[model samples]
Target chain A: MNPLLSARKVSFGYGAGDVLRDVSIDLHPGEVTILLGPNGSGKSTLIRILSGVLPSRAGEVLLCGRPPRGYPRREMARLLSVVGQDPPVDFPMTVESFVALGRFPHQGFFGETTPEDRERVRQALAETDLYGLRDRTLSTISAGERQRATVARAIAQGARVMLLDEPTAFLDIRHRVAFYEIVTRMKEACGIAALVASHDLSLCAEYGERIILLAEGTVASQGTPVEVLTPGNVQAAYGLAVSCDRNPATGAIRVTPLRGMPAKNR
Target chain B: MTPRARSEDGRLRPGPVFVLLGFALAASMALSASTGPVAIPPREFLDALLHGGAGTPARVLLSLRLPRAFLGLLVGGALATSGVAFQALLRNPLADPYILGVSGGAAVGALTVALFLSAGASPLLPLCAFFGAALSALAVFLLARRKSGVSPERLILMGVVVGAFLNAVIMLMVTLSPPGRIPGALYWLMGDLGLGTPRRVAVLLPYVAAGVVLLFLLSRGLDLLLLGEQAAFQTGLSVERVKTATYLTASLLAGSVVAVSGLIGFVGLIVPHGARALVGSGHRRLLPAAFLLGGAFLVLSDVIARTASPSGELPVGAVTALAGAPFFLYLLRRNGGKS
Candidate 1:
């Protein structure tokens, strides 16, 4: 199947140094792609580049065969949505109202909310387990709940592709699992192409259909979990000793760091 | 629980609130029209308004008081709507119409006409003031903007810097002027509705109406703006375009008002907050609510300015500042705890 989103040798930098260099990836519909990187490995920057929030310094990124910048903002948003790490904290708005804003692209500039828009917002709130907290102000909610609200907003956008930057960073384990489940369900139901930037190695291993491990502005490894989550690749990328084993319950690759550093780092 | 929860969605039914505010504005205008040194009774004021009687009370009510009240309404409503737009554009609740250098630029333009041209009460003054305001607003926006984008903090900082410099220039002009060349310039600087002729009111109506309507149309964009720039852009808003339109429209409203009625402070700053408190922060509702509330507030303040003392009239700005400063402090204290 053709990829819904593709990046070819995308490079970006701020000031002098490059944050990402020669990075390429593809995300096909009905698949979850986990982007793995340490701090400053340009995961967030790459996501921004792909979303057209920031232009790449070099190389190409295409969403549905056109450069992201080529599409009008609303048209681009109708196809792809992004969930950032932080929810808007400055304004006083309820969760329901906030989530409904994701329907902006679908609605006319002066359009009132249609029943379909309402239904989508309701379903997004329900899926994210935010129905109970929909009336609560975003500022009044807990960080994890706010993060879920952010995800709910993106889900309400009804986009074919979703790029989430550490969306579950503040979520608890249960919510984290639920988040993955929601993405998986969406993948199956709507065939969305999701690229989630995360540090949840084992969790993403179980959920992500493809994994791309990035190290120092370059792709260290890319493939299925077994091919990319090996001991040598993890140590080489992260500079830490880690043992990769299989989860007994699900038969997925599990990565656990050893007590000390790797011999090369030492 | 479900019913109560649904009601808590922050969407206050806007219809009743609008009716209440409209009534309040009408009542305030009547109160302003009735209260003066002459003190026309409400019955006679109503009679004069309907029949257009050619008596002293009718003459005062029609020619002087009603025009002044209508001018106050336009000025206050324009200032408040401008404030709401500025607040949304900057993504900061503290932003006011004059928070950019618009007010200072208007003052400088008025001063230049007053000092150099010796043009007293000429219509050319307002036009010059508007040009000055637009120029300064554009300067602030351009200075704050970088290749990446304009950050709200940087925009506000540039506004402050430009405003202070313009203020200094104003002071220099006032100080160096031959004392007799600019009469009532100080009072004008302090803000007054005394110049609210029927012609002035007619002139300002289209500006306020256009600005308010434009802002209403951009209400959805403003709602998304509170989400911050990147988030708004990601949500399908053309963020920069919206910001540009909002800034220009807001500047036009403020500059025109300042030209007609000199530097009225605090109405722009405080009225939006009151409106937000009444209706939620949805711009479509917030803009009208703020406009009505501001009209009522300023008309009442004008009444107080007219009648508060046994002496001559005080500038309307003095009355607003007297009320607004303490309320602004209270808001600051309350919001300080939240951040």
Candidate 2:
């Protein structure tokens, strides 16, 4: 079976410095693959490259079996959907209206949303449990609910691949766990090859089948959470000495980085 | 659950009917006039419009008030549509035709013509102003365009800088001019609609009509653009192309209006907000509503200006700013002091 997205030696940056350099990764079908990295470690940059928002400075990227740019923009959008971090929109759209915008790639410029498009939006709202608050203004929603509304929008895109950037960064502990559950359910039921960029090691441990660790604009490790979420690896990238233990209550691994004296500065 | 949710096609059938109503409003406003310095009866106004404005009253209407009224409609519609486009392209609520250096450039050009040279009723100043407005808009675009595309914030920042600098240049030109032309230059800066002629209208109408049509068609793209650049692009939009087309169309519309009307302020800045209040931000509704409501509002303003002072006609710009300023403050207060 072919991977849904492939990157090889891809590099990119702003004028300041390199954000992602010579990075290669693959996202496969029917799996929840989390791109785990510390903050400012090119996770969002890699997502932009694969999603074709930012041009690669060097090397190549492919969506499905061919060069990503070879796909028409609409075709690419039909193939992939993305939910970005910090969902700060300044429009007056209601939650339902904003979600309806995800169907842009699937509809003609003037074409009204068909029955199918409406149904997709309805399903996404139902899945995200936002059906009750669909009429509420997006500005009125809590940050966590807004985050899930964004996820619901991606689902409405009806794409095969889903790239999410910091999906739970602003969520409280409860919503974080709830979001992970939703992620796993989406992976099984929709079979979308998901690449979620996150800094939370616990969320990766609980929900991610595979974790790709990005550090200093390159991939530091790629494997199961047990292999990549080691204290040594985390300390190497984050410059922090950390201890890992299993939480008896939830049966999930937890990472605790030491504070004062910077814990020997890694 | 509202029983299967609202369907898209099942919405808003009364759209075209409203457009027709708007046309009737504009026509009635145009035909309904009073006996003043240039007295023309209402019946004669219609007769002149249908037949030829060859009779005394008809000729007076054709030559003066007719052009003035039509210029108000064209300028109002053009400015409002341009405002809508600018707000969408920049994704900023405060942007308007004047926000982008077009007005400053046109002011400079008109001042130069009024101060440095002597002219008859030849429409030379407005032509110069048109070129100046177009050039300033082009400068804004060029300064903002970088590697991938023009950033909205960069475009707006550049427009503000360019506009301020252009105003400085106009000030220098005026200061350096002969003292005799100072009053003329000052009058030119204040912006009056009397500079309009039927021929200027002929030139200005096509650009405004074409721009409004093109922009109305691209209304959906504009709506998508409010999502910011990356989101807009990821949703299958050709952001660069859309941005260029919209900027070109908007600048032309705004430029032509300023060329003829001489820096009419506040109409474009406020009309879109009013329309959005009535019709919502969906551009399909907002565009036409803005056009009609803007035209109606400006015509009424012009009438008030005509009737305001007994000694002489006040500048349309002064009148507009006065009428629109207090209303803008009220809006700000009413909307919880936003913008």
Q: lDDT tens string, model 1, B183-271? A: 66677777899888788788777777888888889899998888888888988999999988888788778877887888888788799
Alpha carbon lDDT of residue A195, candidate 2? Answer: 91
- Spell out the clash pairs found in candidate 2: none
| DockQ in order | 0.66, 0.37
The local distance difference test score of each candidate is 0.87, 0.76
Per-residue lDDT tens digits for candidate 2, residues B146-165, read 98877556776788899889
Give the alpha carbon lDDT tens digit for every residue of A74-148 in model 1: 999999999994766655678998899999999998647899998999999999999988877888899999999
Give the lowest summed-lDDT range of ten residues in model 1 chain A: A257-266
Candidate 2 lDDT, tens digit per residue, A110-169? 537799998999888897888888876666688888988888888888888889999888
* Candidate 2 structure, TM-score to reference: 0.84
Residue B298, candidate 2: alpha-carbon lDDT: 76
TM-score of chain A of each: 0.97, 0.92
Docking class of 1: medium
| Error of model 2, residue A219, in angstroms | 1.5
